[model samples]
Target: MKEFLGTLGQTTARAYGEDLIDFSRWFEESDGIELVAGLVTTLDLRDYLSHMLTVRGLKPSTINRRLAAIRAWLQWAKRKGAINDLPVFPRHLSEPKRAPKSLDRVEEARFLRSVAREGNVRDNAAIGLMLYAGLRVSEAVSTKPSDIEIGERKGKVIVRNGKGMKRREVPINADGRGMIGPWLAKANSDYLFPGSVGGHLSPRTIQELIKKYAYQAQLDPNSVTPHVLRHTFATKILRSGVDIVTVAALLGHSRIDTTAIYTQPSWRDLERAVDGREGGNGE
Candidate 1:
């Protein structure tokens, strides 16, 4: 397991390690078997899947992630001659398709108002980048003052390290400029949002910050996250008739299909459509 994890990047290794640990615990507790790569059978994998779905009631995505980790480890073991023959892995469980969650107009207004009311310039600026410019939390934290360029009539935020290390420029409008300008003027560190230890603020800190203001705004803190803010930005932009190609670029998505998901009607939109239909409601 250590050798397998060593081949992966640090972040990926940490996640795969956690998944492997859970699988190891389950292997010991359920079947009284040590988690050796060669000794594991197809039945063991099936039983693990059954346990996750029926006993633990974990989401398909969660189950698949763990399964993927195990599959990768097994493949690695086979290459190193630790296992001679591979077990036939079960097909991954199908995950339900749902639109990514985003704040409604009311929720956005309430949340932003709450932040504006008491949040420091740093907080407001960080949140604004996600809500307006569609920055991922990591991208927002890693951003430097030099990455942002605000002109009299136009501006853009350059995300140097987006998902998959792909770089893209997100245009900033008046609202984004207003929120970010104050902080940029006052920022002293290389990071736009500096941490206590003198590096960028961790993504976890930004998530917690969103939760804090969500609670203050009388919204469910669990429902409000930095990703939700990014979703809100994407949804709003798509609804305003922005082209999918453009939106994909703004969100740093390599595929147009990823951006197309925002075009799917939200629950609220469906509800409004049904509510406004003529003569069908009385039936």
Candidate 2:
């Protein structure tokens, strides 16, 4: 197990290790099995899946993740000659498809107002990059003052190390420029949003900051994250009739299908459509 985990990155190894521990404990306690890779049968995996879904009431995604960890470990054990034939793993549980969450116009206004009321220039600008420029939290934190270029009528933020270390340039509109200008003027640190330890702020810190203002705005803090803010930006841009290719570029999505999620109707949108049709019928 240690050898298998050593092949993974530290964070991934830690998570996969925890998953394996859980699986091992359940194997001993529930099934009286020793959890040897060679002796574990397909029935054991099926039982584990049932236990996770019915007894633990785990989400499909969580169950799938745990199962994935187990699968990887077993594969490694097989390659090392611990097992001659691999047990057939059960199929993953089906996860429901849902549109990416984003704030509506009213919620966005309230959230921005709360930020304006309580947040400093740094907070506003950091949030703006995600909410207006559609930067991922990592991309936003890694951004330097020199990466931004604001002209009289136009501006862009250069994401040097985006997801997969791919670079992209995102144009900044008036809203983004308004929030960023003040911070850039007063910027001193090498990073735009410096951390206490002298590096850029961690993604968790940025997430917590968004949650703080989300609570202040009287919105569900769980629903309003940095990714949701990025989704909001994408939704807004796409709704304005911008092409999908353009939106994909702005969001640094390699695939247009990834950007197409913004086009999916939200629950609110579906409700409004239904309400409008009912009103028309009544009229």
Model 1, stretches more than 4 Å misplaced? 1-96, 278-283
Tens digit per residue, CA lDDT, model 2, 1-283: 7889999999999999999999999888876767677777888889999999999999999999999999999999989999987789899788866669999999999999999998599999999899989999999998999999987788899999988889999999999999888898888899999999889999999999999999999999998999999999999989999999999988889998888878888888788788889896434
Model 1, global lDDT = 0.92
RMSD of each: 7.4, 6.4
Score each candidate by Cα lDDT: 0.92, 0.91
User: Candidate 1 residues 1-283, lDDT tens each?
Assistant: 8989999999999999999999999998987878789878999999999999999999999999999999999999999999998898989798655568999999999998999999589998999899999999999999999999987788899999999999999999999888888898898899999889889999999999899999999999999999999999999999899899999999999999898889887777777778779546635
TM-score of 1: 0.67
